[model samples]
Target chain A: EAGVTQSPTHLIKTRGQQATLRCSPISGHTSVYWYQQALGLGLQFLLWYDEGEERNRGNFPPRFSGRQFPNYSSELNVNALELEDSALYLCASSLYRTKVAETQYFGPGTRLLVL
Target chain B: GIQVEQSPPDLILQEGANSTLRCNFSDSVNNLQWFHQNPWGQLINLFYIPSGTKQNGRLSATTVATERYSLLYISSSQTTDSGVYFCAVEQDFGNEKLTFGTGTRLTIIP
Candidate 1:
């Protein structure tokens, strides 16, 4: 089975512009999560979607938002981007609701660069 | 929120050697995962051990949930093991999201 897939491996945008990242989870998976990994800063949780509902969001600003589709794929939107927003955006999926515990599988990540 | 820390920050080893990495979390967790981020930036799931012990080939992991710590052991390490090892956890005993550690950078010499 395919693990997880992401689109637009690399993106370059300027400040105040808008950017969107996409992710398709592994087949038969329900939960989709987004994270940001900056150069110095550690990986920070961005958003979590389950069964097409926004379950939880991190401490990021309102500009960082995302939604999950019926097929369990997700899209992360970053509006009014800033230089600090440049990072590797990763998406992970898990066999969450179907199993007792979850083992998240990650994608190759989309490198977002804001100038 | 839960905080995860990894040490010794970095490690350098020779081929055919062994190494151990540690991860400590601030609070209790029900979902603990160990991943290896390759040089090309792909996060590969290494283990999904929340508690107890598990072994896979030359790699093994042990998590003492009560103590809030986990150990990853790589025996007879190879050059392919050179990369960053990360430890992530899910809080509230749920699997919606994960908080990641800073990670340990391991380099193996030939």
Candidate 2:
């Protein structure tokens, strides 16, 4: 089985620009999660999407948003990007099941450089 | 918000040596996992150990849920084991949002 996959291995953008990062979950997986690994900030939970709904989010600003499509793939959008927004954005997926803990598999992160 | 702390922050060991990394969470967690972030920036899932002990080849992990602590052991370490080890946890069962710890950077010298 193929693990999670992400597009645009590297991305370059300037201040005030918008950046979009995409992720395709593993087959038969129904949950997608977004995370940001920034300098000094460590890895943080950006957003969580399951069953086409936003389930949870972190303490990031409103400009950091994302959506999950009908096919379980996800897209993370950063609007009005700042220099601090430059980081390695990672995507993960898992088969959602209630009351049972499921393992999450991650993708090769998209390295975003905002100048 | 739950806080996850990992130690010793950095470790350097010989290829044949063994090492243990520790993670402590502030609250009760229903989901806990260990991940290795390679040099190429890929987070590889190492283990999904919420409780008890699980071993995979040269690597093993034990999570003491009652004490809210987890330990990852790497036996006969290899240069390929050089990377950042991260521990993440979910406080609730149904809500699966993970809170990651500040990783431990491991360097294996060959």
C-alpha lDDT of all candidate models, in order: 0.92, 0.95
What is candidate 1's DockQ?
0.66
Would you give me the overall lDDT of model 1? Answer: 0.92
TM-score of chain B of each: 0.97, 0.97
Worst 10 residues of 1 chain A by lDDT: A94-103
Residue B13 Cα positional deviation in candidate 1, in Å, after optimal superposition: 0.7
Positional deviation of residue B83's Cα in model 1 after best superposition, in angstroms: 0.5
**Runs off by more than 4 Å, candidate 1:** none
Error of 2 at A41 (Å): 0.7
Query: Which pairs of residues clash in candidate 1, taking residues 3 or more apart in a chain or in different chains?
Result: none
RMSD of model 1 against the true structure: 1.4
Mind giving the per-residue lDDT tens digits that candidate 2 earns over A7-86? 89999999999999999999999999999999999998899999999998888999999899999999999999999999
Q: Could you give me the TM-score of model 1 versus the true structure?
A: 0.96
* Docking quality class, candidate 1: medium
Q: Candidate 1 lDDT, tens digit per residue, A1-115?
A: 8989999899999999999999999999898989999999888888988899888888899999989999999999999999999999999987766336688899999999999
